[model samples]
Target: MFQFHVAPSGDDSWPGSAERPFATLDRARAAAREAGGDAVVHLKGGVHTLARPLELTGADSGITFQAYGYGTPEQEEPVISGGRVITGWQERDGVWVAEVGELDSRQLYVDGRRAERAALPGLPGEVRVTATGYVTGGGEPLGWRSPADVEFVFRGVYPWTEARCGVAGVSGDGDETVITMAQPAFGWAGELYNSTWEGQSSSGPGLPTRIENDAAFLAEPGTFVLDRSRPGRHVLMYLPRPGEHPSRTRVVAPVLERLVSVAGARDVSFRGLVFAEATWLRPSAAEGFLHYHGTGYYEGGGVETAVIGEGASVTYPAASVTIPACVTFDATENVAIEGCRFTRLGASGLGVTGGAGLAVRRCAFDTLSGAGVEVSGSRATSIEDNRVHHVGLEFSGAPGISVSGTRDCVVAHNEVAHVPHCGIVVGSGQGARILRNLVADTMEVLADGGGVYLSGPQGDSPDNQALVQGNVIKDTHTPYNFGLYTDYGASWVTVEGNVVLRADNTAVLVVGPPLENVVYRGNFWDQDPLGHDNPPSGVTYGGNVTYKDERELNAATAGIQSEAGPRR
Candidate 1:
C-alpha cells in the first residue's frame, strides 16, 4: 500500500512524502503509478486549483484521492478546484473593482453567496431598436464604459428559453439604452413564426421579467459587473454583506473546464475530494440544445426508443478545456467515488459512461448548472446514498441523476431536491433498481416535467425490467409537474411501494401511446395517481393508497433530510 501526499504549498519535485508533498495532482498520480496496486494520494485541506484537466487512463487504475487533515465523516473534505480566487479589490467610484484575467464566465461567487450578474434596473419600454435591446421604461443617462463586459440576460423569455448575450455597443438613442447584441438575437432565436432574429415584441406586453448583467443593474449588494473593455480585465462588484470589503471579501471564477477526468480505466476510485468552481459555456449553437419533440416514443416494433433528451442535453463542442466535468469516467470498470462533493460547477458533476460496478456513493452535488451525476451505457453501476440539489441551474431539461441506457444499475438511498427537472430517471435501456430514495422540491421551472420520469426503452430491455420502489417524492410546485411520469410509449413498467406527495399535477402521469402492461401497486399519493389524459392500453394499477393529509406520509419519510445533509 503506497501513499502519496499533495499540499497547496508543496513542490512537484518533492518525493510526495507527508513531510515534503507534491504540488500538483499530476505529481501524486505519477508517484502512485510508480508504486502501483492500491496506492492512495492524500490531498491536504485547502484549494488545489487545476490549470488543465487531470486526465487519467488505465494506468490510473487502483488509485484514490482522499482528503487529509480536514473534515469528519459528516463534514466536507478539502476542495480541488478549476477556479482561481480573485483578490486585490479597490473601491473605484463606489464600485469594488478587481482585475481578473481575460476569461469568460457567466457564474460568479462573492463571499460564498452566488452573486447575480449585473442587470437592467427593471422592465423595458414598448419600443425596441432593430436587433438591439429594448428602450427601457426608465433608461435615463446610463454609463456603459465597457460594452464588451455588458451582457443582456433575459429570464423567462419562454417556458424553456433564457437568453444572455454580450453587448456590442450601447447607443443612447434619446432616452433609450439601445443594447445591440454582439451576436444577433435572430441568429440565436431562429426563425420562429414571425419572431425575427431581432427578438420580436411578444404579442402580449413582454416576456422578460429580469434582464441582468449590465452596469445599471448593479445597485444591490451581491450583484457584480465584469468589465472587459480594459487592457487585461476587471470585475466590478457591489458588496452588500457586512464586514466584507476587498480584503475581507473573497471572489472566485472558473479557470479550467474540468478538475478531474478519467477514461478507459478500471478499478480506480475518487474519495473524499471536493470538486468545485468548474465552468461551462452558456448554451449556444456551438453547444446546442436538442429539441427532441417528445422523440423518446418509439413507433417501430423492431427499433427501440433512443435515450435522447436523457442525460446532459447540451452537446458541448469538442474541446478538452471547454467541456468541463467535475469528475468524469468513460468506458471504465469497477471504480468508486465515495464521500465526495460536487459543488459550484458550471456543468455536470459526475459523468460516468460504459462502466461496471462504478459506485458514486455518499457524495453531495450542489449549485450546478448541469446534471448532478449522469451515467450512460454502464452495466451494474451503483449511485447510492448521495445528496443532490440546486442543479440544472442554466438548463432545465437535465435530470439530477440520469441513469440512461444502462443495465442492472442501482440508484438507491439518495436524497435529491430543489432541482429544476427530474430527480432520478431511467431514460432508456433497462434493468435499473430505483429504491429507497427521497426526492422533493423538483420540476421547479420547466413547461412539462416530473420528479421521476421514465421514457421509452432501448431494444435491449423491456419496461418491466426496471423497478421504482420506496421513494418519497413531494412538493413539485410547477405546472405540468408530477411526482412520477412514464411518458412516450413507456411499456410494461413496474411502479410499487413509493410515496408520492403534493405534486402540482397527478402523482403519476402515463402519457402518449404504445404503453402496455404497466403495473402500479402499494404506492401512496395525496392526489390522483394517474394523469387525466391516460394512455390507451395495458395498465394494471391496484393496491394503491391515496391520502388527503400529506403530513402523515411526510412523517413516514421523516429522517430523510437529516440523513442526507446538514440543515440548510
Candidate 2:
C-alpha cells in the first residue's frame, strides 16, 4: 500500500513524504490518486482548517484517511475544522464585542461550549396572526435599530417540530406593533398546516413563542447575539460566563457548510480524527424552516395523510426536505468510519445516502444541532458501538441515530443519551436488527418519541423479518414517550428480551397506528402497558415479565446494560 502524510505545519508544495507532509487533505488526496492501487493518508495532530469542502470521487477509491501516530506516545488528535476563531474582542458595558466582517452564522461556540443566541423568553404581548404578518395588541416596542434581523420562533403544531420565520420589518409606535414577516415563508408555513390537525391553534401557523437576535436581548450570561444590520460592519456581542474574560476565551464561528463531501466513491475509510465546527444556513434564509417530523420539512408544500384500515398512506409534499450533514456520503460503496469524533456541528454529524456496505463503529457524536447520524437509501449498513449525546440542540425533533429507507441494517451495542428526542429510530427498513443497545435520558424536550422508536413497515416475507432484542431503555420522562415504541404501521417484527426501567406517560413496548404481525415476548419492564392484557389483531404478547419493584427490575437488566455500549 502507498502512503502519504498531511499536517498543519506542512506545505502543499511538499512531496507528502513522512518527513515532508502535505498542508491540506486535498493535496494528500491528490497524491493518493496519483499513487493508484491502494493508499493510506496519515493526518497529523493539529487544527487543519478548510476553506471549502474536501471532495472525493470514485477515482480516489481504496484510500484510507487515518490519524498519524495513532495509539502512540506522539499521538495528538487531529481536528478538521470549518470554522474561524474570533479575536480582537473588546469590553463594552459588561459585554464583549467583536467585529466579524461580513460573517453570518446562527451558531456560536465559546470555549468549546455552545452559546445560546440572545432571545426574549416569549413574545412581547398578546399577538394575533394576520395575512400580512402579525399585530400585537399591546406592547412597548418603541425603538430599535434593526427590527429586520429579529426572528420570530414558533413551535410547530406538533410538539416535535419547531419553525423560525424572519422578521421583514416592525412598525407602529405605542401600544401596537405591526410586524411584517418575510415574504412567502411566513405565509407558506401558516397555510400549509391549516386544518391539518384539530390540535392546531386557530391562528394557522400560530404565534411566535419567542423572539431572537438583536443585542437588546443579551442579558443572560453565556448567550450571544449577532448584529448584522450594517452590511460590512457586522458585530457580535456575547455575554460571558461567570469568571470568564474576553481576552482569555476562545470563540469560534462556522464559515463553511461542510468539511468533507464524498460521492461515487468506494472502499474509502476514515478513522481516529475529529470533524468539528461547521454550520448549515438554510434555516436562517427567507425560505425559513418549517419542520414536519424527524428532519423532514415542507417548503411551499403540503402533507396529506389518509389512514386505511390495516393500511395507511401519506401524500407528502413535492418538496420533501431534510437537514443536510456536515460530512456527507452519496452513492458510495464499502465505506468505513471508525473511532472518529464529531462535535460542535451546526447540522447532522454524518449523512449516508444511497450507499451500501457501510460501517460506522466506536465513534462519538455530540454537541450537534441536528441528528448524530442519518442513513437513507443505504443497504447492508451497520452502525454499532457509538456514543451519542447532547444532540438535537437546535432541532429537537432529530433523533440521535435515524435510519430510513434502507435494507439489511443493524444498529447494535450503542450508547445514546441526553437527547431531546428518540435515541435510535429505524423507519421504513427491511431486515433490520436492533440489539443490545443502551439508551437513557432521552425524550427530555419532545413528545411522541421514545428511547427506541420503530416506524413504518419492515418486511413482507419471513426471511426479511425485523428483530429488536436485548436492549435497555430507561428514563424516558416526557409525555407520550415510550420505552420501546412501534408506531406508524410497523409490521412483521419481533421484539424480545428488552428492558424498560422507567417511562412516564406510555409504558414499555407501546404500539400505535395499527401494527401488523408484531410480537413482544420475554421483555422486562417496570409497568405493563395499558392494553397488554388484550392487544389488537396482528399483535401478540407472550412471556413478558413486569416487576413493580425498582430493585427487581434493575436486577433483571443489570447484565444487559453492562454488556451494552462500546466494548473498547
Candidate 3:
C-alpha cells in the first residue's frame, strides 16, 4: 500500500509521508509508474482541479486514486473533481471574449447588448460581419468608456458568423434581465445567476422548458436566440443531458464513450464519484460507474448517480438516461458489477451486446425510463438478487427483464414490480433458467401480457427452453388469461412446482401446435380449468392443488396436500 497526498501546492516526490506530501495527480501517477507495480494514490480532502481528462494506462492492477475519507463501512466521504478553467479574455471590437483554443469559446456580457462586427464609430443597425458580436449594457460597453444605466439584458451567439450579441431591455427590480440565443452556439452556457425569460420562442418550443433551472444547456450547433421579454433567473448550460448526441457525433462525451472505445483494457475499477449530467453518443452497456471494454471486474462503493440526455427535462415524459441499442464488445470475458444504484435511465438500465460470464448482484434499478435490463448476443450471464422496480415508460413495451440471442443464462431470485408488461421474459434465448424468483404486481396494463412470457424462434426450433419452477407469482392482472405463456415454436419448456395467487386469467396458458413438450405439474393454482381443451400429450398436468375459492384450500376436507409432487 502506497500513500501519496495531493494538494494545489506541493512538490512531487517519492516516499510521500503526511509531512512530505505530493502535489498534482501527475507526479503521483509518475511515482506509481516508476514503482512498476500496484499503486494507491490517496487524495486529500480538497478540490484537485484538472486541466483535462485523467487517463490511466498500465498493467491491470491496483492503480487507485481514492479519497482519504471515503467508502468505509462506518462512514465514507469521497470527492474527485476534474475539468479545465477559462483563464484570460480578449476584447475583440466591443465584446469581451475568451477563447480556450479552438475547442471552446465564451463571451462575458449581459443579455440584449449588441456589439459591432466591423470597426465603426457608433453601434450600427446592420453590418456585413464575418463574426457574431455581443452588446454589453448597464453603463458603458465593457472595456470601453461610456455611461448607459440599464439592467434588462439579452445575449446571443452566432457561431457560424463567429460573433455574439448582448442587449439591455428594462431597468428596475421589476425589470428582470434575460439572455436569449439568437443563434445556437457550442460550449456550456454560463451561470444564469438572477435572470429569467418571460416566454420566448425557439424552433423547438419545448427546448427551453427541457432545461432545468440550474441545468446547463450545450446548445445544439446551429442558429437560435435568447429573448428576455419578462426577466427571470438565468440558467447554466454545463453538463450534457443523458442520451444527447453531439452535433458532431465524433466529439461525443469522452468519459462516457471511453468504455466503448477502449476494448480489452482489463482490471479497471471506478469508485466514489458522481457521473451525473452528461450525455453519451450511444448508450453504454458496461457494468460499472466507469464503463469497461474488456474482461474486467468493476466494483462501486455507495455511489448515487444519474446519466441523462440533453433533450430530457423534468417536464418531458421520457426517462433522462438513454442508451444506444448497438454496442460492440471485443471478446471480453468475466465481468461483475455490484453495490450501485441506477435511476432515471432511458431504454434499459443494463444492456449487454456480446460477452461471456457476466454477473450483476445486489444492485437496485429504479425509475427506469425503459426496460430494467435488456441483454442481447451474450453468453452465460446471471442477473441475480437485484431489486428492480417502477420500470416501463408510458406507451412503451417494457419489461423488468428482457433477453434475446443469448445462451445458458440465469434470471433468478429477483424481485420485479410495477411493470406494465411481463415481469420476466425470455425473448429469444435458448437453454436458460427462470427460477426461484418472487414476481408480484406485474403486468400493470395493456391487453396481451404475462407474468412470465417465453417466445420461441420464429422458424424451426423454439427460442426459449427453460425451467420455470418454485416461483411465487401474485396480483398478475391482464385481459388475457395466461399467467405463464409460451408461443412461436417455444418447446420443451416446463412450468412446474410454483404457487400462483390472485390471477385474473388462467394460471398457466400454453399456446402451441404441440411441436415438442410443455409440462405443468405439482403447482398450486387459485383457479381450475372449466374444461380440458388440451390433454396430456406434449402438455402434462398432475398433482396440483386447486381452489374454487380461498376457503377450499384451507378447509378440512379439501383433500389437497400442498406438499405433494407429481401424483400418480
Candidate 4:
C-alpha cells in the first residue's frame, strides 16, 4: 500500500511522507493517484477547512483516509469543516453586531451549540391567506430592517412537515398590512398541499406559524438576525446570554454545501474523522422549501399520482427532492466509513445513494438539520453500532436513520434518540434486517410516525423476506406515534422479538394502505397491541407478551438493552 501523510501545519508542496506531510487533503489525493495501487492517507489533528467539496471519482478508487496512528492516545481525530469563522464583533445598543461582507447563511453555531435565528411567534395580527399572500386584521407592522429578508415558516398539511417561503414584499401600513409571498413557491406549495392526503383537512397551507430573520424580533438571548438590505455591507446582529462576551465567543457560519463527494469510486473508505459545518441553501432561495415527509419535499410544478394500492394514490409534486449531505457517496462499491463524528451541520450528515458493498459503523451524529444517515437504492449495505441524536434541527420531518429502495441491507445495534421524527425507517427494501437497535425519545416534535417504521413490500419470495427483530424502542412521545409501525402497504416481513415502552399512542400500529402477509410474533410491549386481538386480513399476530409498567419491561429485556448501542 502507498502511504501518505497530511497535517494542518504542513505545506502543500511536500512529498507527503511521514516526516514531510502535505497541508491539504487535495494534495495528498493527487499524490495517491500518481503513486498507483491501494493507498492510505493519514490525516493529522486540527481543523482542515475545505473551500470546495473533495470530489472522488472512478479514477480514485482503492483508497482509505484515516486518522494518523488511529486508536492511540496521540491521535486526535481531524475535522474536515465547510464553515468559516466570524470575527470582528462590536457591542452596539445592547446587542452585538458584526459585518459579514456579503455573506449569506441560514445557520449559525456559537461554541458548538446551534444558535436560534431571530423569530416571532406568529404574524403581526390575525392573519388570513389570500390568493397572492396574506392579510393581517389590525396590528402595526414592526420596524424591520429588511422586509424582503423576512421569511414565513408554516407547518404543512401534516404535523411533521415544516415549510418555509420567502417574502416578495410587505405592503400597506398601520392597522392592516398585506404581505406578498414569493411567487411560484407560495402558489406551488398550496397546489401540492391540496393534492395530498393531509390537504383534505385544510383549505391551504394557511397563515404562517412563525416569522423569522427580522431584526425587530432580536430580543431573546442567543438569537441572531441577518440584515442583507445593504449591498456588500450585510450585518449580523446577536443577543448574547448573560455573562457572555462577544469578543470571546467562537461563531461559525456554513459556507459550502458539501464537504466530500464520492461518485463511482470503488473500495474507498474513511475512518476516525469528523465532518462538520456544511449547509444546504436551496431552502433559502426564491423557490423556498415545501416539505412533504421525511427528507422529501415538493418542488417545481405539476403533480405525479403515485399509486400505493390498486385504487389508492397520493399526489406528489412534479419533483420530490431531498436535502444534500455533508459527505455523499454515489454509485460506489466496497466503501466503508467508521468511527466518524458528524455535528453542527445544516444538512444531512451522510448520504449513501446507489452504492453497493457499503459499511457504516461506530459513527456519532448530532446537531444536524437533516437525517443522520440516509441510504437509498443501495445493495448489501450494513449500518451498525452507531449513535445518533439531536438531529432534524431545522427540518423537523427528517428521521435519524432511513434506508429506502435498497436490497439485502442490514441496520443493527445502533442507538438513536432525541429526534423530531422517527428513529429508524426502512421502506421499499427487500431482505432487510433491522435488528438489535435501541431507539428512544423519538417523535419528540412531530406526529404520525414512530420509533421503528416499515413500509412497502420487502421481497417477493419467502427466502428474501425482511425481518424486524431484537430491537428495543421506548419513550415515543407526541400523539399518533407508535413504538413500532408497519405503515403503508407493508408485506412479506416478520416483526419479532422487539420491546416497546412508553408509547404515547399504541404499542404497534399497522395502517395506511393494505396489509398483506405480515406477521407480528414474540414481541414485548408495555401495553397490548392495537387491533391485534382481531388481526386484519393478511396479518397474523401470535405469541406476543405485554407488561404493565417500566419495572416489568426492563426486568425482561436486560440482555437486549445491553447489546444495543455501539460496541466500541
Q: Please count the clashing residue pairs in each candidate, in the order shown.
A: 7, 0, 52, 0
Give the alpha carbon lDDT tens digit for every residue of 405-484 in model 3.
77878887787777766787776667777776677777775435567777764122345467777666667875553566
For each candidate, give its TM-score against the true structure. Answer: 0.83, 0.95, 0.49, 0.95
Lowest summed lDDT across 10 adjacent residues in model 4 is found at: 195-204
- Order by TM-score, highest first: 4, 2, 1, 3
- The digit string of per-residue lDDT tens for model 2 on 1-568 reads 9999999999999999989999999989988998893999999898999988999999999999999976577766999999999999989999999999999888999989999998886666687778878888654443545777887777745666677788888788466888888977787776555443433234346877778888878889999988888999999999998989877888999889899999999999999999999998887788887776777777875555443233433233456689999999999999999989999999999999997999999999999999999999899999999999999998888899999989999999999999988999999979999989999999988787889998889898778979999898999967877888888789988998888878874343334467898888888888886568788887888998999998988888788667777777
Q: Candidate 4's C-alpha lDDT?
A: 0.86
Query: What are the lDDT figures for the candidates, one per model?
Result: 0.67, 0.85, 0.44, 0.86
Best-fitting candidate, scored by lDDT = 4
**lDDT of candidate 2 vs native?**
0.85
Tens digit of per-residue lDDT, candidate 4, span 446-543: 89889998889988878988999999899998888889998888899999989888897545434657678898898888888778777888788899
TM-score for predicted model 1 compared with the true structure = 0.83
Model 4 earns a TM-score of 0.95
Query: Lowest summed-lDDT stretch of 10 residues in model 2?
Result: 307-316
- Where model 2 places Cα greater than 4 Å from the true spot, the runs are 138-140, 195-203, 305-319, 505-512
Per-residue lDDT tens digits for candidate 1, residues 375-462, read: 8789999888899999877656557888778888888888899887678777777778888788888877665677788878633346
- Report the number of backbone clashes for model 4: 0
